[model samples]
Target: MNYLARDPYAPKRLIEIGEAARGLGVTARTLRYYQDQGLIRSHRLARNVRGYDLAAIEQLKAIVALRAVGLPVAAIRAILVLRDQPDAQVRALRSALAEALREQQAQIQRLAALAEGMASDDAALPPAIAGLQAPSPESATPSKP
Candidate 1:
């Protein structure tokens, strides 16, 4: 009893905002925001209602994945366009990604250096400051009047 065979005229699945949000593990508000930002598209079902078909769902997934990797919405849009013209765009996108990676690596090195410096400073703290300790719990509490 194959369901598809039984119903030859089954309509394509049109996911509503809530269902799509749940599928993506995002809030409906976030979905709406993405829609507003023009990061993803939705089929208008009515004046205030919207739905997403399979293509739209896949596009939204791509948007989420790109955003997760720190690509800005503008960059994601450009990358999406590159999908249609890969040969023409690959070099540019690769250059941009390489630049971003270099920037991130530099930031990581700066943070590591700062952390190492702080560790050394802690090791060299003045004896008076290093020897200070919190008051014992009993001493911290006031006696009853």
Candidate 2:
């Protein structure tokens, strides 16, 4: 279901590049880069002006979201193409999201271990940092026993 195409409120009015970028909390260059990447198309208002309709704005929103989660431009371009194919889009997105979740879970474990080590100020090197045999130059100052 292409919701952007079906939106009844989609105005004929054009949103210029700067406005769209501001609304999306991205730079104008980023929007232009997406156009260059063929992820989204914008209207050519004049020789120097670029514009986007509401549908394209929605598409840009999706692009921004996908990029936020560490997906590269090539991956985003593929996802945008898949939007035209519902079955494939769902399958691809699910696979990407599942992989992201797995990666995030592993990252959380590593960060939690680091945090635990940092939280214990008095401990003689928590297990996570126990491999080190020498303290840094900054830790040369002896600690109280």
Candidate 3:
């Protein structure tokens, strides 16, 4: 068995941070932040410049999508940690999505409750209060003699 054989599916060329950021529709600072948060890893090709492999870019896409849907950094990290295990990864992703859905549903319920309360309060307002309006400029100004 040739252990050194290159996988055909692997990225043939690495891309710099700027290109990766632009391709991902994110800023270089955001990529750096992801690196800092241990969410994604970048290759240090030289003294300061960083590059990313295709796998890294794919990971960034997943991160961005997860974030767009309101998944927190911690949950994203947890999902990433399960990447190596295909079965576990699916389970983890599903669990995270379920949790996010529950949270969104709860938030919607809370907002609906608040809106209903406000509606009831508006209905209960005294007629004078409900009818009150700010005086228009024309009404405020005295009529010329």
Residue runs of model 3 more than 4 Å from their true location after superposition: 1-12, 118-145
lDDT of 1 by residue, 1-145 (tens): 1111112333356677778889988777777877787777766543445677788889889777766655666776677677778875676567657766787898899888666756864466455556989999877975321
Candidate 2 regions exceeding 4 Å error are 1-12, 122-145
Worst 10 residues of 3 by lDDT: 1-10
Candidates 1 and 3 compared: the better one by lDDT is 3
| Cα lDDT listed for each candidate | 0.68, 0.76, 0.78
The local distance difference test score of model 2 is 0.76
Q: What are the per-residue Cα lDDT tens digits for candidate 3 across 1-145? A: 1111133443446677888889988888888888889999876544456778878989999998998887878899988988889899889888999999999999999888666756864356455557989999878975311
lDDT, residue 83, candidate 1? 77
**Could you tell which candidate, 1 or 2, scores higher by TM-score?**
2
Candidate 2, residue 121: the lDDT equals 62
- Candidate 2 lDDT tens digits, 1-145: 1112223444457788898999999989899888988988866664547778989999899888987886667767776778779999988877777776787899999999877867866757666468767868987994321
Clash counts for all predictions: 0, 0, 0
Top TM-score hit: 2
